[model samples]
Target: MSDPVRCMTVCRVCGKEDWLDVLSFGPMPLANNYLAPAPSYDDEPRFPMDVIVCRSCWLMAIRQVVSPDVLYRHYVYISSDSRQILNHMRDVANLAVTRFHLPAGSLVIEVGSNIGTQLEVFRSMGMRTLGVDPARNLADLANARGVETLAEYFGEGLAGTILEQYGHPRLILGRHVFAHIDDLTDVINAATRLLDPAGIFAVEVPYLLNLIEGNQFDTIYHEHLSYFSVGTLRRLFERHGLRVVDVARFAVHGGSIVVFVGQAESQWPTGKAVFELEELEVRSGLTNEVAYQRFAERSGRTMRELGALVRGLVSQGKRVAGYGAPAKGNTLLNACGITARELQYASDTTEFKQGKVLPGTHVPVVSPAYAHDHPPDYFLLLPWNYAKEIIGREKSLLEQGIRFIVPIPEPLVVSNESLKDAAFSLSHG
Candidate 1:
């Protein structure tokens, strides 16, 4: 008999209580990266791929499960892939050290330090640094760069070991890693234990408001077990003996919030930005199911419009392919009901994912070189946040006659010639 099909109709955060049937993105496959059908794995199971809102807490999450080991191991995503990110990290590192007045030899520990990108910035500042990450290849790679990395999944046990061996960290940082852990209790407890009495925990996650307001349903894939708003975060951290003191919005990953946390009883006043978010959540009835129902309604509409636009292009005999093979792209593709047949392929600069196919859709990923050699009629920029960067870099290809298509907010068609010199222009202006 085949494995039983699992479906989710309730809220995960509040369990069965205040269960709100928000929005369903319909059936989507396991979108970490599509694996090929091999004799060793003849028939693999796919999840329900539905995301529901907890009417009680208003937290949004996927309704399926993927082993953490399989999700993170042999990871392909790298932090240093974009030039914009490099600059962002540089500024963030300098700001962090100066704002906190981090003394020399003060420990700065990063959880999910992918390839040691940000920590390397810290090392340049003469600070003691440690990276705790689960991915074996990434840990090995970080170690190769002379950055001390522990290849173990982080929890209370790892925190215990760290406290025993290295003492408490002055700064604990996690970017895009905070929402990855489902069992937040263990990691939050571990972080509290690993923190110095006066230590600060800095986390960057996609703000739940932005995810809803901007229609970023793609961020709700299997890897992300929780979507956090300031309200939800306040309750979560306080329960774990940690206090969230500040929140800052960043342009990275579409729109993200960097929350600065400390021990729960600490006397730090909440930042104005944090208060603004809290009030926003209150106005939206963040703890109620009504807001989620409205958000879900709009999201389905957006997805349909996007799908119609793409399909219209296909019906016109235009050759369309995608740019930037991102996890968010999986959600966009899935929401738009895009099959491999609709998009010829997606080109990624990341060598690790270049040759591998997309996790569930089976859309092959190619290098930017593939576009140069076999230019298509349209280049669909799925990671539209980095559209300006990608479009600028691929100006040479546009010079050879390839058009750029951006699908966010709404589908817009633009040319590379005008945007080719944009980064420099933005810098000078």
Candidate 2:
């Protein structure tokens, strides 16, 4: 006899009980819980991260539900670290202002606004920006930097408070956060109530199609409760009396989309992109269980290939180091079973994560100066999504014979002459 399947039975979106088991990453710790003083490995907590597909709604999610308090109260991942992300947010804000005809002095509220990066961009555009974040430290930092932010989680109750204080917002947005909420129903319900009738409610999330097609299995962690597709998002929004009017794809965070939504009765016309993408997803079997099963199979092969590559390098007396200390990097390291023994140390630009050790693997993290002073034979590109930025910034290292190992869509080593001056090099073994 085996243990019973211990998780939610009903889907979060639709009240459907039909689910298909797709991928299981087994027991894993919180990806963002990097240890500053390096806690004892024996004391760390690991939760089962088995992902399942809701056949009725086509929503993919991890059944193991970790409380928001456990994962986000002391959040360490800040959006201000990457210049690329900042520039992307600026473009999003500018587009929103132009498309929606938002005037100066209009209210803009962002949920899960880490360090208020996006809100800062909105404020500079003459909009009165407000941020709601659960992380106390980050909220304080944002407030100190002139972004009016409330250190509280957004919910129906908070929505009432915002309406009372600031009135309805002209625009409400959440970037890379719509998937993290365990109770998205409450959040969406609140957002609809707080949004002005003609206001646009924009959200950016990791697209499920991109995740499966790009082989970004490492993005699956306890923090990300759901992987969304436009089809599922449309259904979810429609259920709340909101319609997704416009959808645009971006090359940020592997692949993502900014969905513009408004009240069902609003005048914003639905764009053809939404239906086109939805049809593409259906054609790709995104709503089918078999596609997810195949994704799981492909992910297993990737883990094995990445492991073999790292072990082979280590066996040849080559020193390996990680380029970034991101949460996705932690998931990739733990899923592939790489540790400090194989990867000597990881380098990061974030001052907070620089002196810490990775959550599960206990891999030490040091400043980029360390890697620059004593370059490793191989620098594993942990934040491979930012490969272009990293390679361009560290062009000198490539010239000094330090090769980069990109472990995404496929595992490859980059030391080719043609890519010496390029953003990222791709040379497969």
Candidate 3:
């Protein structure tokens, strides 16, 4: 069983004890804990899944803390699984190499480098690469693919060891991994130590503003301890003697921000992008509590709407199944009380997830090939972050009159008619 949920009395970002309740999903099983077939539900573990914001720092975070061991030791998600992610990682590597002026033979290290997909890009760019991740299986996969990876959690200790063994890295990249860390200080301190004098530390995380504005509550899982806006990220990095020199936004993963940091005393000047994003955050009311409250209200409404949509479709005798079994999808399913009764099964390309059942929901997971053989009338697109890619790839199904239900921002059905309407609206407007 996983460890009991530990409520935080003090905010991890600002050391303040004042917190404002934002959203709660009551008790929920770990999002990635896919169960064996015919497993006992009574023996499963659940923890409080509550979200709160630090009144002082304006940082959004989950109040309940789960052990990292339970979250990532044998992780199932692979970075290379998604074609969109692979393309995005290649773009990131190219940008980093060109923008940072990383010369050939410069060392690039990545934290949470699942299966070394991103690191492979850096290597292809003529840069030496290393990866640090806690998932032993993923680390082994990385090694097998010729990407040197360490099967250990990254922290000050591991950072020192890496520095001693490989010397200072020209670039330290953490893509979609920094938000999972509970100790921001330790990680930043380690990055500071492992960075060369002229090196850059680039970290990418899902943008808090996008999460709120897009009503992406499904992204709130135990693994993601903190949600960050540019303002909060600036403060966090500043506290560790690092300066945010540059910021870049990407539409991948719903929305993400890549913040490039350097030593506080470095000659690097803070780019206008950082100031612009910080200003945008203020304009979006991310510095206040009202935005979060509205987000919570909208989240509840989304849950109800998605449930209603799925049930309504089922009532019409239309078969519905989930398109992907992402961790975020589990949160959405469990929170909405959706079960195998609603979604017959979830189809995924990941072999690790095949034959397993979604936590709490008990929705069986099947291979994409199997799902195609027994296609449902409608597919609930679980990985809405990759909506365009998935929908485009499944064009044949849409042509065959199959529809997809996108449950984010608002629950809507995507069909040929909807596509034409959207295109017409955009072209006319």
Candidate 4:
């Protein structure tokens, strides 16, 4: 079935009607849509991915609409599977406990929680944890692992049910989930209602500055409705009588900001980080159309360079297999016109993705063990943001003269010695 593309006539942040077209990735497949082996190439569906920025608020968003039910009903990603993500969650859980001084039985709730990665950390610390998620598989898995989860979409109505069942929570959180939602007002209202008067509500969003500076245009997809800046985020919360009390930046998912929100009447003072980041966004022209225009130009250049490198290698009879079959990878592959002929297959760590095929390009998905049995001459790091962890995990391949090709930020080849040196620098420095 084909998905519908609807134009967003109003700015989600400020309720303004003016929006400027920024970059168009053309028609692309749903980033997480992995195909069965029997499905023919013609059966695959592709939707338009036109990114636009609000002239009033400077928020970047994909106006093309696709139903969340079609995108996340049977999601494949499990946060605990990624080592880096698990570590980050642990760090966050610990900080929440210490910084907020959460009691032993304090309630912690995470909306859109995937496999209870963060909740599990809190549960281990003797805190009562609950996960609210829509993916049935993930919800069931989390329940089996002792993290009680509700398998339903979250909103104002659902928040009432939670409030009636479980008392107001001390902490409410979401990671990389807010941007995926279309109705921000409902979600924020729900969180505000369920939070204790003095409780903290935190969310992690991929930073817009990092996306533009790193040339990560492939991150745009139907699922992510908004590209937020601190200024826009602050405005959104202030409109709902919620105050952003703290802002912490981290290098996860390329780069992200963890924003802590509380009621407007709460005594917690707003931190300097929020204002500092807002100033940075203004100075960097993050809210301007010209910045996005430059980003589009860089994206085109990256597509040309990546295509030439991979196709040139294949033309010389060299084998190239991709590592990490992420949603962003599919965007890059389709936008760059890369096909199975150019790169033999993509390898992923998740067992569910093994044997499936990436959407659009028909690149077969296999296990990382393939690198040992049928090692490619050059391995393409699809999830280039985790280059350090990936290089360290596959150091054996590096030792075997398997040079890695990182395409984002800049296209470059990493030799064995260079990979070792880079890993050492990352670990030591």
Task: For residues 356-394, write the lDDT of model 4, one tens digit per residue.
Answer: 999888899999787568889998888888887877777
Writing each residue's lDDT as its tens digit, candidate 3 over 186-210 gives 8888888889888999999999999
Instruction: List per-prediction Cα lDDT, in the order shown.
Output: 0.76, 0.88, 0.88, 0.86
Name the lDDT of candidate 3. 0.88
TM-score of each: 0.89, 0.95, 0.96, 0.96
- Note each model's CA RMSD in angstroms: 3.7, 3.2, 2.1, 2.1
Where does candidate 3 stray beyond 4 Å?
A: 1-4, 423-429
Clash pairs of candidate 4? none
Q: Which residue window of length 10 is worst by lDDT in model 1?
A: 420-429
134-174 per-residue lDDT for model 2 (tens digits)? 99999999999988899999999899899989998999999
Ranking by TM-score: 3, 4, 2, 1
Q: Which ranges of candidate 1 are over 4 A from the true structure?
A: 1-16, 36-44, 284-290, 396-401, 416-429
Relative to the unseen true structure, what is the C-alpha lDDT of residue 24 in candidate 2, on a scale of 0 to 100? 86
Q: Candidates ranked by lDDT, best first? A: 3, 2, 4, 1
Q: What range of 10 consecutive residues in model 4 has the weakest lDDT sum?
A: 420-429
